[model samples]
Target chain A: MATVRAALVQEASAQFTSRQPLVLVVDDDPDVRASLQDMFESVSLETAVFESTAEMLQHGIPDRPCCLVLDLRLPGTGGLEFQAQLREMNQFVPIVFITGHADVATSVRAMKAGAIDFLPKPFRQQELLDVVSHALRTEGEKHRDGGERNTVRRLGESLTPRETDVLRGVARGLLNKQIAYELGITEITVKMHRSSAGRKLKSISVADMLRKIDLLGI
Target chain B: MATVRAALVQEASAQFTSRQPLVLVVDDDPDVRASLQDMFESVSLETAVFESTAEMLQHGIPDRPCCLVLDLRLPGTGGLEFQAQLREMNQFVPIVFITGHADVATSVRAMKAGAIDFLPKPFRQQELLDVVSHALRTEGEKHRDGGERNTVRRLGESLTPRETDVLRGVARGLLNKQIAYELGITEITVKMHRSSAGRKLKSISVADMLRKIDLLGI
Candidate 1:
């Protein structure tokens, strides 16, 4: 468990210092891509520019917290359609849509589909940068949550069956005698199993054990 | 606890039957207000029309799950400004913005402020209805979640001090002997308090008690 936790901590620090947060741009126009690339680069943010969804998908997103700056109208598949496809694939990269021509219906559709922000043509540079910052922060939170859940699950997998039963009874507010009666074991045995389980999980208190159990859905 | 739960259930049913879902409309033009009222009423929805934010505030929203259909431009306060005020007042009624001239910046701002949808003028009737339905459903979920949190708090308040101590220890996976040592009570006394707390909270298992304790943030 310590090793796993250490690895996660190291990975997080490595990401912060060694790897830069990325901004993906998918626009058919070369000028727009170049200008956007410059804009993101000016702020010390790494960016990857592509001409279309096909080109972006071919390269795939790197293993880092990232967001997409996509044009609404592309060469073949529209931005909305690409968003739907990503949802189907369970790729929840936050998206900010840029459009040359904006209508209410399309904007509503894009927003409803979970686009981070919709910007019509000639949008302010600062506005796009602010939205991208928000998107990256959101991605960071999501990654941390996922990592914590995985850690909890791994810790849960370390307990013995009897230890699990004893801890489960404790989490539910049951007395040792009551747990023993239910499991047809001695109250002393129940206590032993619970303490052993607590040490294994490194739970300092009943509340911590309860939380980990809840996180593990046990 | 039972009485509180029952009252909440009764209140929910009362809201569903006696009180129909409401759609509040705020528009400067009387014609727009009248047309929106007519549209909502056609679907058996009750509506209150107002010429401005002041008029709506004066009337006050009824105690029910509801949404707002707001015009972007109003006489006194703009739609965006009114939305901000509602947020500050902790009034989170879902909003659907309607505008004659749609701009990306304004639409983005509205959506960021938690507006349900933004529709430009000459929007399809069905589109407006669909958005209203979604907004009402969102409001219903928020109300139910609030009710549940309150119920959990009320249940937490019912525990005696000793009972709460024993339960908190149990929720953290503490053995009866350990909890008794900490509280300077006999193990038998700890067991008695555990059962008593479980009975009061109607907790069938340790997992259930753990969840209730977590919800109470103990």
Candidate 2:
């Protein structure tokens, strides 16, 4: 557990330099940590090996594609408990668990809790890497570049409530005439608001406005 | 294989009746197919097992979240060959392989080719299920309701190229003046185009147009 903390810093530093899927290994065994690190690194994947969940928490979750490789048993908060805590905190990183002893109960509980994969000690290197690869690829689809979403959110915020209503209707493929009729407003009013919204959003044409809005998911 | 194919048809019918993730198992063994189908169905996942990739192809790819469980050695096209063929045909599905006797070379090759998990026969049911769970969860993110994307595409096709350029600039957060200058057009012309495009798209306001476009991903 102690040696895991020491290696944690090195893993964090290496992770910042590359845009690869991250594997966060939390194990008490220094040898297991080292072996997992080497295996992941061999395939050009980055890893952050921690001895304890607390130590891993100090650095916070890395803001990139990553998966957790947890040992079933730990010093303070065991793998299962930490997993539950993460869920409570609304953190959704995929987790793969490893343990020396195997039990049907532990495996079933882990899977029910959404653990990605569980392996007994002395697991095959290729087998573990393959599971990690799948985890990362799956998580990749969800790591939607947080910064971009924020900017889009801010842009949408500039719209008036009435404008937003029209926007939603239009985005959902409703005709302006239909939107106005449904909202008990004149089509002319809808056109005027649409024009104003484009001006505020800095769009130059209808296509441009729609394209921008679609991308922003406004 | 014959029994597997029979079960596959049943699985396909069940999958069509619901939105569960499809686990396509390509194995030559009947016992393997029946066991895998029961395993997946128990957890509410749909299984489409085939004795060979060719037989699997006959069913075509199901239109839903899916992962492939491949047995490395098979008649006609082997697991690896079918994997490559799928790639050539532009199909990308998460794959898990099962083999009676495993070796380092084959495991490495399979993982490198993007197989999700590799298991030796007599694998724990939990292990296979966990891997399948990970693959399915990951694929879920990439599945964005195909029908919606199609509708969006059709709406986008209605826009003119010039309108699309304007929309792209707007989506990128550019100002009308900036877009006009970038496109060598006057700001007034940009406004007129935007307004007309809005009318053509049936969006009453600029915000409406932008919203519609965003949904269409133009």
Model 2 chain B lowest lDDT segment of ten: B144-153
Q: How much TM-score does chain B earn in each model?
A: 0.76, 0.74
- Please give the distance, in angstroms, between residue B112's alpha carbon in candidate 2 and its true position after superposition: 9.8
For model 2, residues A1-218, the per-residue Cα lDDT tens digits are 88678567645654452356788999999998998899889988888999999999998987778899999999999999999999998889898888887654465466657776777777888888888999898677666554444445556667898897787676666778988998899999998877777777776655556655776776
Summed backbone clashes in each candidate are 6, 15
Q: Can you give the TM-score per candidate against the true fold? A: 0.76, 0.51
Show where candidate 1 strays beyond 4 Å.
A1-19, A153-218, B1-19, B157-200
lDDT of 1 by residue, B149-174 (tens): 66666667778988888877886678
The residue ranges of model 2 lying beyond 4 angstroms of the native Cα positions read A1-25, A30-51, A54-77, A92-218, B1-25, B30-49, B58-69, B76-144, B173-177, B187-205, B211-218
Every candidate's DockQ is: 0.41, 0.07
- State which docking tier applies to candidate 2: incorrect
